[model samples]
Target: MRKNLFHNLALTLSLASSSFLASYPTRSNAEGIMSSSPITVVVAEFINESDANWWKEKYKSSFKNMLTNALSNTGNFTILEEDEEAIDRMTKKRSLGIIPGFGGSKKEDDSLQAKYIIKGYLSEYTENEISESTQVDFGAFGGGRMKQMFGKMGMNASPGGTQKSIKEVDLTFNVVVINPRTKVRAFTRTIQGSAKEEFLSEDVDMGFVKSQKKVENKFPIKRAVMQAMEESGKYLNCVLYLQDDCIDEMDAKEAARQAGNDAMDLF
Candidate 1:
């Protein structure tokens, strides 16, 4: 009877351990293996015009090409080439409701034949000028008495103030991502930075004289956009799905390490 009870207990514990291990999520290689699938993604047209007058239409094509190339480099998804007529037909069918959209219906998930779709908006791209100013006051006072009988020379005091200006460029970018099937937002992020320019002005006795500096292409705006996109890509891959498991594992490892240290403290 004692042996049988011990055997049952051991079996139960073994089974429980197996169940826990099976349920624990392993690190995913989906990102590394994205290229092996027949997934077709539609890179939506981006709207790059932010302020009405400052539109650079050439940037629209440049941005689109950059995005396409970046996504292809991930080796996870096969981007539909521009010349694929079948993809065009599929796009039209989905648009006309002849076939369900890429993310529309679970029932059509197998039939739609595409794993995922990507859509984005270049919500904001603008350059702003920021300036800081400071003021300082200068004064001189002098008084002298020459002769004992008569105070000869005397001088009054006068104070004057001057102001100076410093200017910098502030760039901003906002991005958004959506799941094509459910029309739900998957990720969003913003990037902003300020860059200082060389100031040529100096304070003079007649106030201050400075030349108007032209805004050169400093690439701060492009750098901010690229950073935002990179962040969005990481969020899409690991944050949305695997973050919880990774966090739990980290917590468990930390706890075990602490417990081991506490035990060793007794020595």
Candidate 2:
């Protein structure tokens, strides 16, 4: 079952990502003219601290590719092929160059056009099984002895067969966009999403019987991660460029402009 579900995760990913993320604002000048320069961005594969090595190895490409592809799909950014060694060097060298008395500068950064590096990590990547439950009245099965014992103890005895169980799966991650030049974390967010499958057994009364015998999973971890990425990608541009606050202003202005144009059409 694990192998079968793992193979089907790709299909779920496409279905999950069908809806594109939020609107992205174009960089503009003082004249409000949009800048044509494509924002350059680089992506690094997310780190996995989850003890699931198989999971990390399975979905590493999805984690990295989704970020870059999400940006590119906006048609406002250029995804740059970056060298891992060069990026590591820049990070270490940048930290070293900042001195209290001196200044902060890096020669390599001067030539680099990419302004943002998308970083991410998996906080949790696991799935668990769930069981449906219903309460059964043991009084119908003639439990007068239990009632008498409870009555002596001044306690009302309810049906011991009354049981309830639930199960669910979750995928969560922390994503950040950073500016290498200033060593600033531009945008930081944590996204948690889940994909639940149909109930294995609709008979609530019997669902919990031997529940632990078989673990039922609705979807693979990759699907849940993909679902999370799709949602987080919505705020990518806003966080990277600090456009979250001003997006509302821009939309209102555009709406007013349209209203004025409609009024003039009456002339």
CA lDDT of each prediction against the hidden true structure:
0.48, 0.61
Residue-by-residue lDDT tens digits, candidate 2, 1-267: 998898799777766666332233334443343335667777777788666545646466668887777777667677666556666655555556532223333535532546677788887666676655654443333548755665576544543332234545676678888876677997776666677565433322332332222345535655676677776665665444444565565456447746865897899
**All candidates: TM-score:** 0.43, 0.52
Off-target runs (Cα >4 Å) in candidate 1 are 1-39, 83-89, 95-114, 131-219, 239-267
Residue 17 of model 1, lDDT score = 100
Q: Relative to the unseen true structure, what is the C-alpha lDDT of residue 127 in candidate 1, on a scale of 0 to 100? A: 54
> RMSD in angstroms, candidate 2?
22.1
Encode model 1's per-residue lDDT on 119-162: one tens digit a residue. 44565444555444443322221322222212222211111223
Worst 10 residues of 1 by lDDT: 149-158
Q: After superposition, how far is residue 173 of candidate 2 from its true place, in Å?
A: 1.2
